[model samples]
Target: MRWSETCLSEQLGIDPGKELQQLYLRILRQDPALTLDPPVLATEPAAVKHNLPAQVTSFNGRDWEMIEVREMITEHRLVTLVGGGGVGKSRLAVEVAQNVLDDFPDGVWLVELPPLVQPGITAQSLAKALSLGEHPIVPLEEVIEDRLKRKKRS
Candidate 1:
């Protein structure tokens, strides 16, 4: 198969255009006056599992850092990027996550930590990002851990 086709089909395991088309059709049906509901996405493990937002800008040239981060993520279960503000950390992270989605069958999840989030709510924020809504009976840390553990490492 062609390289571009292989990336979309094998790595992402998605009909690249179908997802976007679905969103467009759903948006077209929404009533213009009413506030749109929060994303009602598929919850099944069988579904294409990614919550990555569309990239607004292009990633230009950072080949070395990309290679390093990708290798680290593959070797370690978790990798953190530290840098000053405006250092393109988020973009680089997102780009690397996109590249490595295939290595993770369950999904590659991105949890955002904005300054607005209160210090105490870090775990809750991650749970929300993963779309595991308030589970009153169970601790969120456990819930997040359970979800992450599902995909057996390659």
Candidate 2:
């Protein structure tokens, strides 16, 4: 823990819970975040819900493309960016995902498909990407689908 977090926690009379709140935070992600200051925590437990990578480099141009992609994603549930490698497809996807993070209360999730070559294991790959390591007795796809279904109902 950072000195700022500890010092501020003590100064504000905060007593952290046993076993830590983070142990079950992914399920706790919802509307109206309740995280305390410093306004932005570097490794906040609420943030653990999303696996989206941070934007490292400065992004420029593609205003029209960004708008189109954003509109498509908003209007349609399944939006795929079809482009060749090195054509900024991934960047556009990340930008759109980041922009729409608040729209999905459950969490904004991204599955990197580059490492996957076999279609047969795509579900398994996605489960791995989601870090859903529940006992194999409960099918991962069922868990993933059930989660999305519940989100859709809300």
Candidate 3:
């Protein structure tokens, strides 16, 4: 089952009975040999999780920009959103991430880099964002890459 459907049924407590019934009826009409069982709700543990900050204020406007950013992220491996302070760049990114959360099987993480004083510790910051501890033998970048590769495969 898709995570969105699972979330809708489990997290939000929105009963999927109507939708399921429609599908079941349609399937039964098409084929009598098929059997449909009630779906079991289970919370699959996320491979990667983040404590994304909640949006306190309502979002306004920027529908087109959000769509463009979402498309860019879907098509490209990397995307950067640049804008001046208080221009809603961070808010926009968070919204986009939330919108596409179900698309990423592993998970979506938000790494806030504003507190970092030096550029050299960027990798460390990323590691912290991913909740990765220091490895005795493997390098941080290699470890991150391997984990990402595994997630992509799944």
Candidate 4:
């Protein structure tokens, strides 16, 4: 069935421009299975750490009990700074992310999926927010991997 459609489209002499449209179609059909070689990730080293925002106030000993948590975040590759409401966890994450934004040359991106009420659609909301319109048909993991790789590069 697909072969016939391709043949028909070919025989019709309907050329949607041999350059741009063909390239666009190639983009639409890009897949590892279709092509022997796939695109490679950027090999640039990580960016240097940048200075944090001056607006961030330092944590007082008694004020932020999450000092250990903050230290863990600073030390670990990935830290989940979790806490109760109004417990300064978000504030801490913002500060930490700001402090290390330069280290992540891609930049500190805060994806606020507040309007995304459904957990199932969180990825879609994030993709839209990030302006990553490609690969909508692919799984969320693939989208995230692609975005993270691109972010790491630039």
Q: Judged by lDDT, which candidate is best? A: 1
What TM-score, to 2 decimals, does candidate 1 have?
0.58
Total backbone collisions for each predicted model? 0, 0, 0, 0
In order of appearance, the predictions have TM-scores of 0.58, 0.55, 0.58, 0.44
Please write out the lDDT profile of model 3 over residues 28-140, one tens digit for every residue.
58765576787886976545454568888888899999999988977754466776778888898899888777787667777666645876476676678778887999988
lDDT of 4 by residue, 39-138 (tens): 6778867554432345546754443545565466445434554456677665666665665565666565544345446775766655664566656588
Off by over 4 Å in 1: 1-46
Between prediction 3 and prediction 4, the one with superior lDDT is: 3
Across 1-154, the per-residue lDDT of candidate 1 in tens digits comes to 2455567788889655766556556667874754667887677457756778789888999999999999998887657687888998889989999988888877787776666457647677777867887677988888877876665555
Candidate 4 — which pairs collide? none
Residue 59 lDDT, candidate 2, scale 0-100: 82
Candidate 3 stretches greater than 4 Å from native? 1-48, 115-117
- Model 3 / residue 13 / CA error / Å: 51
Q: What does the lDDT read for residue 78 in candidate 1?
A: 53
Scored by lDDT, model 1 comes in at 0.76
